[model samples]
Target: LRKSELKGLEIPGKLERLIATFFADDTTVYLSENDDFNDLQKILDDWCLASGAKFNIGKTEIIPIGSPEYRDLLRQTRFLNSVDGPKIPEHIRIAQEGDAIRSLGALIGNNICQVEPWTKVLERIDQSLDQWARSKPTMEGRRLIISMIVGGMTQYLTKVQGMPKEVEEKLTRRIKRFLWDEKTHVRINKETV
Candidate 1:
């Protein structure tokens, strides 16, 4: 793999030296060992000079990852606790436990937001079904609608990971309900529906 010029995050076993994703380098992520910010600051400063852009400190988030014990160790880092070290601006403080960080349109880290992706998919499906219910479309039309809309949802949402069994069942139930246009189960044959 090509080495990143903006090296920071350390990959175990020297696999890679940096972690980064770029859209013309507008946003970059660097991992500092513990809470050291001096290296990151210098890196950003260099990038700004080269690109003629300013780093936005206010929009920055410092999501702390690792076990609670690891976090405790991070808190005790000399740079983190130091009054003499280069100061981390107040708005760019490390995330507390239970805080969720949204990355690439997905909420991750601690808390209920971990389930946000599926919740949103479920909500969108319900809303769309409710609105489309008014049209009273033909069975073929409904089948087409589900294939076009709900089919994509199922494919995208379940692509990378297995969902909770209950959630999977609920999604199947919702689609089944929509297909039959029934509020309750009618005991119809599975293939017939």
Candidate 2:
């Protein structure tokens, strides 16, 4: 509601000009308190089309206006607001953890260290790491571990099969879940598909 908070709104076109000229001094600029998602989305889309700025689709979220989860999620990540564009899932397209896990999978398969499928995967991983570094860089000692959840099938195929009983037992102990956690990335099994 504050003047500084206006920077977060996605009011596009002449509406933005109107806001700046007349309501710039006003704390609250409301059209209708009962605006629906489609209505708000229309306003946002118009704003983005008029403005040259690109919205970071990976960093945006849409939540029920009054829900506690909405507020909590927003509070946790500031970029969740001001998302007035198309949504892109972060795991496949943006998350560094996804890239890291994919690279490790290649390494385990002995596909890395050479230039095959690993080359493409490595290139993507390099880009993801570079982006993450640019956003929130840290030294090795201070970096946080990104947990990339794997499916039971991938685990069974990668870690269980073709391994000694002792090693398989050790790996089973390390995995906390039997099911895969879903994300935006795709899991490929070349032999099957």
Candidate 3:
């Protein structure tokens, strides 16, 4: 759905502070520090009814992003109803501190700064590279794979999440070894003319 269809879904007074991103069929709404979840939910329910679109509560989540104390505060608060007076069903899940939520191919935790998600991405890349290495492609072919496949995988994540320098270095070393078929322990030397 489009943003125009979901207009007026933001909390009344906090409209200026809300941050919402719509990509394809996914819509992410970020409320301000002072916004109330109940109010936003009500608006969403109303929008769904008005637009004749079903609100899939099963796929929806309320993730608290902050310190432990702040998250605890969220945990204590109970969400009973939407602004329109409809009760929220008990089957809808609220994300806990250690819960891993996938959003747009990136893993998210309660704390926004956690790097565990990036580790998962790295592990996937390593597995893919290992599988490709089994084919015994030429060094030039390996370099092309590194540039196109590996590089493309991290390009978006690095720009969005800011990968650590050490991780980049380690991945680079692994790619180098894979390029040489992991036979020689010595490093590959390039002599300039």
The number of the candidate with the highest lDDT is 3
Q: In candidate 1, which residue pairs get closer than 3 Å at backbone N, Cα or C atoms, i.e. clash?
A: none
For model 2, residues 24-110, the per-residue Cα lDDT tens digits are 322222322122334434554666689864545443333212245544443344233423332322331322211222322333221
TM-score for candidate 1: 0.75
lDDT ranking, best first: 3, 1, 2
The true-structure Cα RMSD of candidate 2 reads: 20.4
Estimate the Cα RMSD of every predicted model relative to the unseen true structure: 3.9, 20.4, 5.3
Clashes (candidate 2)? 1
Candidate 3 residue lDDT tens string, 101-145: 777766677645446657877888889888889888887889898
lDDT of 1 at 135: 94
Q: Is candidate 2 or candidate 3 better by TM-score?
A: 3
Error of 1 at 94 (Å): 1.9
lDDT tens digits, residues 1-193, model 1?
Answer: 1243444567788876666666653465765544347666677788789989988877787665556765555545434433346556655656666776655544555443435467878888888887887899788988888887787776755654336677778788887888888757577787964
Give the candidate order by descending TM-score: 1, 3, 2
Candidate 3 total steric clashes:
1
- 107 in model 2: Cα distance from truth in Å? 36
